[model samples]
Target: MTEQVVTGGGRRGASSAVERVVATVREGVKTGRYVPGQRLVEADLMRELGVGRNALREALSRLRSDGFVQIEAHRGASIRRLTREDVAQLYELREVLEGLAARLAAQRIGETDHRQRLVAALESMHEVARTAELPAYMDENIRFHRTIVELSAHPRLEELVDQLQIQTFRIQFRSAAANHDRTGMREYSVTEHQSLAEAILDGDGTRAEDLMRRHLRHTRSGIMQLPDGDFA
Candidate 1:
């Protein structure tokens, strides 16, 4: 018995359905609610989401395009399994995207609103870090990076960054969930992220980009170094 909340219909509801389904599935993937290479049967998903086959498949199709799920000829849609190569490729692309975002953010970051958002986000991360809340730290980790990308003030950049983040997240989430040394990682990441916020606030895009690229590089290397199934 899957409990799904479905309300509204027609034009307005259509867009909302897609977002709701995507968020639900993304959360499941991030938290290991669905395992790596988990086969998603349409019928089972329909029941689980309390949505029709069409809506469920639409969501799956979007995720497929996003690289979160792969649609193979015979295997259908399954969660993507990240190889070392995939991890390398994901971080490589992320470094470029984040670097560009930071560059753009430096010139465009005059708005107090964006600054406030970043400050608030960093404070939330500090609170979680003090409590040693790994889950909270991880969630804030995502928010912090995304907030920097959002500062680019370019819709297209924002769009591309969102997709790239999703692709990178699949690998990171899987590895971190299983890594035994991840608690220490949380602390390290918290400090690095706080520095990133300060850099952005200083309006030094170059430094921000440098910090982001360095962070991505270090993270990718560390995750790759971890023993298989040792990423908790």
Candidate 2:
């Protein structure tokens, strides 16, 4: 993504038509832009986004596979709803997979451009958070977490982590912005990301692994405690 673009809706970078639709829908799910179990209107979106029907269908299919959309037998695509059980299971898997990814990424990252890329991503998220631009914060959040997973050396781990991270975004975005008190969560995330980067740069696999595990545990707890809706 280039420099951040501020849309009338909010701050999001420029992307392709289908990608733009996917992201708009995803954030809608995240920030209550769309409510749970809300049905998508292809005609409406096509008009709003200036895309054809095929592009909208493709985006919905992709999102359904990613666990963000659910298509009923007779009812078209609607945003997926997370039951209490669904949230618990997702958080459990996320805790384990993400911790492992971070540790593994730290095993291979050197002290150069790749590490710098992650730091930049984390800082960008921080800036968006400070500015109260939730969508940009969410975008950068995905990028920063993916940077760690991509460096982890195992392709399978990377894929699994990516899936869990999507679920994480769905939950957290549905919740609210991290509060001032939870600034600790933000600082801890940024600081650990920096430390993990250094660990990989140094090729200290053991430390990287341990830190990643701890980081995931912390994240799971922090996220769960944050105020979800009355139902959550």
The 0-to-1 C-alpha lDDT of every candidate, in the order given, reads 0.76, 0.68
Candidate 2 local lDDT, 40-72, one digit each (tens)? 988889899887777778888888888888998
- For each candidate, what TM-score against the reference? 0.80, 0.66
lDDT of 1 by residue, 19-66 (tens): 777888777786667766788887777677677766777888998878
RMSD of candidates 1 onward, in order: 6.0, 8.9
Candidate 2 residue pairs that clash: none
lDDT of 2 at 126: 64
